[model samples]
Target chain A: MNFDDTPEQARLRAEVRQFLAAHHDELAHGDGAYLEEPGHERVDELRRTQAVLFDAGYMGLTWPEEYGGGGGTNAQQAVINEELHRARVAGPVGHVGLGMCGPTILRHGSEDQKQRYIRRLLRADDMWCQLFSEPGGGSDLAALRTKATRHDDGWHVQGQKVWTTLAQHCRFGILLARTNPEAARHRGLTMFVIDMEAPGVTVRPLRQMNGHHSFNEVFLDDVVIADSERLGDVDDGWRVALTTLMNERMAVGGGGGELGVRSDVLVSHANRLLPRLSEERRVLAVEALGRVLVESLAARYSGYRLQTTLEKGEHPGPESSAGKLTAVRVAHATADLGLRLLGEDAVLARSRDGDWRWASAAASTPGIALAGGTDEILRNIVGERVLGLPPDRPRTPAAATATPIAESR
Target chain B: MDFDIDDEQRNFAQHARDFFSEQAGPEHARTLLAAPGEAAPGRRVLAELGFSSLTIPEDFGGVGAELLNMALVAEQAGRQLAGPSLTTAARVAVLLADDADRLAAFSEGRLSLAVLDGPPSGSRPSMDVVGATHFLALDGDDLVIGEGRVTLGEPIDATRGLGYVELTSSEVVAQDAQARWARARQVACVILAAEGLGAADRAVEIGLEYAKTRETFGRQIGAYQAVKHRLVDDWVAVNQLRSLVWWAAWAADHAPDQLPIAASAAKAYCAGTFETACETLIHVLGGIGFTWEHDAHLYWRRAKVDRLLLGDESEHLAAVATCTLHAADAAATGELQPI
Candidate 1:
């Protein structure tokens, strides 16, 4: 087993480094936080930055060239990812368009849909957001209430989606709606591509505790989508949705600073704060930081394992769940250390000081757990899928009837 | 770059696992627990499998495989709760690379060896040393090889023998061996951590298997989130340690500059993770787990001993913390690239 990249991979990494150095000003900075901008200027900047990567052929390193991908090896793709991560710049697009939606479409979309969407998606000519999670269904996504009815003209979609990221800026959405309510919960759902600016579609930003509006509450009031836009089969949405969900785990498992703060950032924070801390506090801080460093390294090495699997052309198993969970756990621990070091500065949310970055990171971590999957759900996935443990039995009507009596008692 | 062992090493590990299962599996370990006076019961089989010469030089009539191959077999050895024969022989063979006669005898299973590592003074505990012929030890910055008087300690995890030794006659094989000792300790940490990982992996599997079949309150206990999540967390810890172990072994072979920090991280992390895995196994097994008939305690004892074998978790963590800060300092000055 080896840790160092091969000569070819090293060359790819160097080329990426040279490209980033030459085009740093044109790319998204601070790990793509600027891409979350709520204005037209940010959209324009995103397109420009994405065009740079698309032009450089850095986008879609492992995707087929027929679909505007680089048609490269997974190791080469991993090298590009590592370089991008080291440069602390978000890649060509966010997780929604590049990581999740594009991959789903490439796999399950019709030939026409692939021809129409994949290139634009990769080029950021059209931004995308996922419209799967509903107000009533966050972790239980298959239980969504969104209804898409058949019509001669198209399908009319009516449902409310909460936590729709970048909905206001996205040109399209990869949506999951109930197509056959008479069918089983998972079997009845279908995946669709709906225009975000279509009539009767409204996007309202949700203010987070961190005071960011990165998420939204999207309302679809009888919005019409053409029949050709539907992805996968009529009732095969769950399978297609699985494709996206799998990619979501992989995307989040990569553990860029955009999802949550990286551990190296916390190490730097600890180093900067250690001298000012009292000797007693310093000991506690170091101990806490040690655990973070260890787990962070674990998360990283876990990513390497996943990359190895990909290189061998095997589908990653529940290792992604473990990786995402470990990343979130590291984020929580890193944030806790940040708050402890800040003491009073943690509460000063609007401060312009460097200490507030840690505070911001702490505040934003809850969203990380909510994204892709919650902590409990991922643990259940790991338990059942990875460990081969029996899954939690679904609650039956009889059990629900008895629950009222137990609650009253 | 691959982060996994090659197919040959993988097949060898599988062969080792099969050999241990038929020869020195948990049942055999239980018998050893019943009789702590037994020397390394699997020593002859271990040498037969050629694990004894995994890292020794080819000139010494050994396989001359790298450290990672030794680590892969060490993991399998840990899984079956085999004796410390593999650990002691692998370590001693590398430290005595210059002694062709001893190396050949060691490779041929004529020279039984035990190893001791500590601050290099007074008495230090060595495992599986009840009937070994020679003892290799560290003595205040010097590496020593000699005959020693062994006083057997009461067996806590009796899958292997444990004893403290006082060297009667010895020679300083290497003077001022601080750097070599550190490297040797790092190698030990990697091997022990790999062993702990193997044990931890088996313990979790056992727990998971029992959870699937063992029923409580009219349902399989695994169906309950509390039990399932605990098992899942333990499984995650196992993965964490597995990655660290692979990286540590790889670093030892291919990236010596990264070995010290990588091994410390693996040792520190594996100590806690392995214990958690064994504890989770016992908890999942419920009452039967606490009984002597159960193999859970064997793993528990192994974890407890391995945690303190070279240094405990906190000591290794301190080393990790120091390295972390130094790396950060160097990165700030652009002396080293931050990973």
Candidate 2:
């Protein structure tokens, strides 16, 4: 298992560093630390920086050049990501579109869909959200009751999707709905590219505990999606949705964690408290740091391990589930340590000097347990797909299982 | 570039697993535990398959393989959970990049080596010492190999073959033995961690099977979140252990700079992961797991011994912490520069 990048990869990384150096002011020094899911203004700032990245061919390093990418190896993509993360910039906007929706369209969408959607998505000219989960069924997404009746012109969809991030601003979404209710749950679904601005479609911002309004509850009432917008065959939505969700899992799992979830904060915090810490506390704090460090390393390396599998041209397999689970667990651990160390001040929001990152990371981690795939569902996926354990009963694979990290090889 | 095991390594690991499963597996463990004795058969198998000389340089008439190869096999040994001892690892390490002519003798089944690592002043229990003809003692800063008169002592891990050796005369193999000792320490950690990973993998596998088959509250216990989540944690740990073990093994070879830090991390992390795996398996197994006849306790006992065998988790963890602090200080003081 090699950790050092090859010379070619190193050269590419140097080039990327040079690119970032040229664009540092626009990328890293734009404003206060950008959140993972930034506000519209921050996203607009991110788009400008991402446009710089796109022009330099760092934005879509591994995607085919025909689709507005560099056509580079997966190693280059990994390097670009490492350099970007090292620079502390919020990554490009429209990650859902690029990582999940764009890839899914490239795979399952018709030729016209590819010609229309892929380049714009990669350039962050448009935004996309997943319209999969409903208020009735979440972890059990296959059991969703949204209706999509077939029409001569298109499919008329009526569904409510909760936890739809960026829907308030997105012009389009990947929607999953039941096209044939008489069939079995897994087989009766269809996937569509629904225009968010279409008639009878309404998006309401969901206020988070942290007072962030990034998540939205999207309501669809007979939303007429044109025939050209259908992603896959009617009543085969589960299969196409699986494609999108697989991309979603890898994007979420390997994308690292949300805002305020950086492990560095906790590490630096412990370092600061060390000189004054009592002997017992010193040992305790170091042990906790070591544990969290191990978890973080494990999560990071799990992504690398999965990347090797991608390089081998196989499906994402089970490690993404493990990655997702471990990522959130580490975030939770960071929060736990943050609270214990800060004591009464831990609950204070927007503390002086912006100490709220820790408290906010802790407060926002629960959303992770719900996002991507819920903890319980992810555990089941790991158990069944990764560990070869017998499922509670034989059925379709989890929505987030079997994706191959947005590339065929 | 790659973090996952290569196809060749995977095949090697598979072969090791098959050998252990067919030969020195749970049945073998039961046989040894019934009488509480040494694993002489396991020793013969190790020598027969050239596992004893895996890392011996080609000039010494051995495979000249790296630590990663050893880690793959060692992990399988742990998975089979029925090895006689990990003594082969120390012998391999002492002879790794060595000028010695011991590989042929070892591969030909003429010599068996036991590596005892601890303080040299006092007598401490040793492993891989049962019926061995050679001994390598890793004292604090000195590495010495000796032909010794020894007496065996009973150990909690009956298979480890713990004993004491009195080296009347010894040859100092390396004067500046720090590098050699570090390699030994790191490779040993990787081997044991591979074993830990093996134990973790099996314990979790057994627990998951039980969870699927065992019924409680009129349904399979695996249906319950409580049981399912425990197994998932074990599975996650196994992956973590697998990742670190591979990394530590890799560091032992190509990246000498990372060996100390990586080995400490591996040793520190694997100990708890292995221990938790056993305990959680027992939890999953319930009453049947508590019985003397059940195999869970054997792994649990091994985990207990392995955790403290190389100074406990916190000690190695402190090493990791110290390294981090030193690096940080070095950076601040300009003692070290970024690569």
DockQ of each: 0.69, 0.49
TM-score of each: 0.93, 0.90
Whole-model lDDT, model 2: 0.73
- lDDT for each residue of candidate 1 in B219-311, tens digit (9 for 90 to 100): 899989999998899888888888898888888778887887789899999999999999889998999999989999888988888888778
Q: Candidate 1 chain A: worst 10 consecutive residues by lDDT? A: A400-409
| Cand. 1 Cα-lDDT | 0.79
Candidate number achieving the greatest lDDT relative to the actual structure: 1
**Span of 10 residues, lowest total lDDT, candidate 2 chain A:** A400-409
Q: List model 2 lDDT by residue over A127-181, tens digit each.
A: 8888988898888787788898878877888878898987887888899988876
Residue-level lDDT of model 1, residues A181-295, one tens digit each, is 7676677889999899999899998888777777899999999999999999998999999888888888876432235565667777777778988888887777777777888
* Tens digits of per-residue lDDT for model 2, B1-339: 778777888888888888878766555565665575556346677767877667766666667788788878877788766555553554454544454556566655676777766654334677767666777776555677777776776556666766787765677766667777666766777777777888788888889888888887677788676778888988887887787778878877888777777787788888999999999989889999998888898788788888987668988777776666556556557888421
Candidate 2 CAPRI-style tier: medium
| TM-score of model number 2 | 0.90
